[model samples]
Target: MNRDRSLRYRLAGIEIFAILLALLFLAPFYFVLVNSLKTLGEILVDAASLPEAYKFTNYSRVWDMIRFPTALRNSIVITAISVAGIVTISSMTAYRLVRRPTRFNNLLFLAFISSMIIPFQSVMLQLVRVTSILELRGDLLGIVVCYLGFGLALSVFLFHGFIKGVPLEIEEAAVMDGCSPYGVFWRIVFPLLKPIAVTVVILNTLWIWNDYLLPVLIIGSNKDLTTIPLAVTRFFGQYTKQWDLALAGLAMSVTPIVVLFLLLQKHIVEGIASGSVKG
Candidate 1:
């Protein structure tokens, strides 16, 4: 009876701790949401407290200033195209690497893995220069290409791990059934990648959607191609920051991705866990 009571107590303590930890992570969200409804002065005076009166006008003003629709369209298009390219290229590449396992393929796989360790900061200058030379800078294609390049290594790594778990016999069976190599991959192998593909999409979407630095570098001075992150920066100037509008823009920026994450979050854990175990 005493042991049972002790175990119960321990479990309860763990639950309490988990709840507190979750709230700690959620605290920033609370502040962003609550203060977004307040005026700049109200935020300066008491950001921690709820506004005396919610000023939803902050969102309206932010929407117009940031050109929310254009920003949203840019972010959506870039994220979608980039993620699709990443998935298609990475999955095929991973499939080939796993099935072939030639010396060159092994070396290539190692190269891909190694590139992940190289910091993005280290290559930014060279990337900018190269993009300028290629006339890729300040274009949607430029940013999307950059995303594909940077996103490939990690996506390939994930796909590689997951592909290992897929039975070779399945591919062999498809081949024997007269399925073309392309058909075998697209019809057979690719479908099985749905879980990890969802993981890849969700991860990259969040990264690309919220990314500012890459867009700043590649889409420089192109107001037409401005993403939400770049658009929101208009609220913060060198001398003064519009805290209310900034927070409102942030709230708007995060909503779509947050909804996406909430819907597909289970796939992330499931895919990663499965990949690790299968690998």
Candidate 2:
């Protein structure tokens, strides 16, 4: 009876601790939402306090200034194209490596995996130079290709582990039925990879969409190609900042991703759990 009481007490403590942790994380978001409704003067005076008079016009003004619709369209196009390329190409490459398993293939896999550990900052200058030389600067297609190069390693790594768990008999049967190599992959292997594919798409979509640095470096000064993050940054100046407009712009930038996550959160959790188990 004493031991049972002790365990119950411990569990209660843990629950309380988790609740506090959740509140800690959520406080910033609460602040942002509440303050976004306030005027610039209120925000500057006491950001933590509730607004005396809510000025929802901030959002409307920010929408116009940031060209919010165009930014959303650009982000959607780049994210979709990049996610598609990463999943398709990485899956095929991982499938080949897992199925073949030759010494050369193993070495190449190691090389790709090794590249993931190299920080992008280390190669940023060189990457910029190379992209410029290739005339890939300031284009959505170029941004997609850039995402492909940086994102491929992790995608390949995830697909490689998952592909190993897939049964070889499926491929063998497809081949025996006179399906060519490509047909075997496209018909048999690709279908089974859906879970991991969804996982990759969600993960990469979040990263590429929210990403600021890469777009700033590559797509900066190209007004037509400005991403939401870059556009939001424009609201801040060296001498003075547009606090109200900036907050409104930030809210707009974050809303889509938050909505997307809420909708697909189940898949995201399932995918991560499955990948961890399989990998």
Candidate 3:
């Protein structure tokens, strides 16, 4: 009875700590949400205090000004295309690298893994030059292509480990039954990769969705292809700061990603855990 009580106490303590930690992390979001409903005068007066009156007009005005619908569509399209391309290409590449062992393949895998260490800022100038030479600047297709190239390394590295854990016997059995390489991969192997795929999707979605710099660089001066982060940036200029409107815009912007995380959260945790397991 005493041992059971002690264990219950420990679990309760952990639960209380976790709840406190979550609240601590959510503090900034609370500030944003509260301040978003207040006027600039109220914000300047006391940002931490609750709003005297809720002002939802900030969202409406900013939404129309920033062309929220167009920007949202662009962000969705770009993120979906980029993430799908990353998952497909990286999974296939990782599978091939696992199955076909060669000296050059080893070198290539090493190169991909090592490339992760290189900072993106160092290559930005050269990338811009290449984009200009190829006339890829301001193109949605060009931006998606850029995301594909940049996201591949880490994605392949992630899928590589998980693919190794998949059983060879099952693949061999499928091959003996007159299944082609494509059939075996698509019908057999790919389905088994769902867990890791979800992890890849979620991780890539957050990165590509939240990314501001790359879009700014690649899709410069293009209002049609504006993303959420870039759109939010417009409220802040050299001299003027639209804090009231900006906060409201930010709250609206982050809602989708936050909702997505909550929905797929279980899959995400399981996927990462499974991916980390050794073959």
Per-prediction TM-score: 0.90, 0.91, 0.90
Residue pairs clashing, model 1: none
**lDDT (Cα, tens digit) per residue for candidate 1, span 91-128:** 99999999899999999999999998998899999999
Which residue segments of model 2 deviate by more than 4 Å? 1-10, 273-279
Better of 2 and 3 by TM-score: 2
Q: Report the CA-based lDDT of candidate 3 relative to the real structure.
A: 0.88
Off by over 4 Å in 3: 1-18, 272-279
| Better-scoring candidate (lDDT), 1 or 2 | 1
Tens digit of per-residue lDDT, candidate 3, span 1-279 = 999999999999999999999999999999999999999999999999999987798899888877888888999999999999999999999999988878888888999989989898988889999998998889888999899999998889888888899999999999999999999998999999987888888778889999988999999689889998888787565215678888888888889888888998888777666655632
Per-model tally of clashing residue pairs: 0, 0, 0
lDDT tens digits by residue: candidate 2, 182-267: 99999999999888899888878888998988998888869898888888777664314667777777888899999988998999
Better of 1 and 2 by TM-score: 2
Q: Which stretch of 10 consecutive residues in model 3 shows the poorest summed lDDT?
A: 270-279
